[model samples]
Target: MEKVSFVIDDALAFIVRAPLVTPFRISTGQHDELENVFIRLHASDGACGFGEAAVATHITGETVAETLENLQSAASALRGRRITDPAAVCREFAPAFADNHAALAALEMALLDLSSRVQGIPLYRLFTPIAGQPRLTFKTDITVVIGSVEEARATARRFAQRGFDSFKIKIGKDEEQDLQRVLAVREMAPGCTLILDANMGFSAQRMLAFLDRLDAGGARPLLLEQPVPKQDWEGLAAITAALEGSGTLVCADESVGSLASARRAVETNAVSAINIKFMKSGILEGVEIARLAAANGKRLMLGAMMESALAITASAHFAAGLGCFDFIDLDTTFFLKGDLSRSPYLDDSGRFDLTGAGSGIGVVPELP
Candidate 1:
């Protein structure tokens, strides 16, 4: 394949507000709407690519204002740069973006998208060599955010009716209510795989007790995600050890923000799975982490923050192209209030297909 190179003629960043159908609550906070940053990189050859930065203050500590400011500086630095290798550019810019992973991801995503378009190939082709093959489709899990038991049940039923077989339930607020919500969701979505995400809401002992209760009720989830705080390595290791033979995997989310953190988590055996989010690891680092996790035999899961289809589609292309993730949590787009125009790869069912997309991410969202 001939390499296509082009100078970045223009770079721009803007804010996009996407409203959710309902307030999505986690242990740390709640979101009724999302204010995120979007990036557009225009190549000298008239090709353009898009990216999105979903700002989660609780997770990445990046606000929209700071993200925009940082992006402007990055845009200034990226202009006139010849990009034959987008991933290499991303790595080159890593040091400067140490404090802002989401912004870096937006830049990397835009570069990759633009490069793929310049080559007239789907975005996944850039990653197929690493994956060993191409993946055509992937199923995603829908999240039932922290809410009342009735609300959870209703959400589960609605999604089940829509052919969603995997459910990620947000818990770790009120112990009793959280348990009730889990059980209610289970009742509504029978035989479905359940993933419990606490978002750093519990102590090790408390999380164990909650697990015991779930086991007693025969509703043990398939995975327990980030029950302890992000920096609580001791708590995470203890919980992982306690769940060694309990048929549940301990997955790290907030704890693995960078490649170094992910390496530490794997070396310490603190968790059995790693949750890879572009907003946390950026695109290149996320791929490296995925490779690292796979090499170390750690289960891989791909997730997204509160984002529109534009960002989710980019993630979908990456995941589908790589074909390595064991669990898919790219359901945030389903929570957005509107048509699925931004996410052309996603469908009414919780599935993403990249076969139909054209060059690049194959999604040009109608941003307002």
Candidate 2:
């Protein structure tokens, strides 16, 4: 086993123009551009692995300063360790930061990226065996942020023309306004799958009323994500039951942050699906949570947090192995200025294909 050592080379923060298709508003922001944080981890062998922490202080309470502090602290613990096994490295460094999942995820991802590079195999191939190479298809949802009904309808029409069949609209700002927006979107793109992500901006009663309005408007959503607060398991369950068989499934994104929370949600039947994100639960932990969701008979959706190409590619590698997620939202990199890499994973239809021949994510050109 090679004695693994890593150095925290540089941390870069960039303000990216993440314009929503509509004015996206959650409990977090009404009109905001995404602030992305990128961490670079360099191994002793000159192999570098990158990790991303897209911060939304209002959503996850993780600020750039706090994330950097946690990464620095975790980086110290990761030095001079023989990390021949990526999964073992994750296990070893996970507890170092106590309950800081975001920081721990950064460390684990760097180690995995290094390990795959060392073995001369892509991270997806390292994780699972491919039988029949399937074309990795992902359903990216066009975001409809809080906006006027006419704006929402126009946005829906634009996305429909772009061949996106799924739409995730931000709701819970106003009952009448949101209903109009939903109705307008439905009218514009009647065939597209609709998803509502409230981002915990509504109370249980308000959420129920909104769901009721959706039902009455004949605008059934494919899923409702984080309608209420994360801790309101009872409310989530009630909403789930109320929407049972209404062609509107409920998925938990903020609530299912950890494996334990996923298990709890499964035990209490709080959601119909789990939204798995590498940004939230690291790649390895996200994989474990996906397996747990599979075992518990809950479908999974690999979600993203406005990451760069490196992080999004890493996530695509992970998602390639999991053949169960009914939906995928890996379009974060598409919104970047330029992917900071050469030879990025590109498919025929702009989706990433993981079956190509290469090692350590297949492409590690100098950061562009």
Most accurate candidate by TM-score: 1
lDDT of each: 0.87, 0.68
- Candidate 1: stretches off by over 4 Å: 1-3, 128-131, 339-341
Clash statistics: count for each candidate: 0, 5
Instruction: Give the per-residue lDDT of model 2 (tens digit) for 1-368.
Output: 23434443433222333443223355456435545555455666677665656665666767767777777665665565445566776787777645456666666666677766766666666555222443354545667777778878987887677777777887877768889998898998888788888878787788878778788888978888888889999988998898787777789999988888999999999999899986677667787788888888887777776555666677777777555677776665444443342226753224556656466655442432
Candidate 1 achieves a global lDDT of 0.87
> Candidate 1's residue-wise lDDT over 44-113, tens digit each?
8899988888899976778889888888888888888887767777888888878888888888888888
Regions of candidate 2 where Cα sits further than 4 Å from its true position: 1-24, 76-81, 129-135, 340-343, 346-350, 362-368
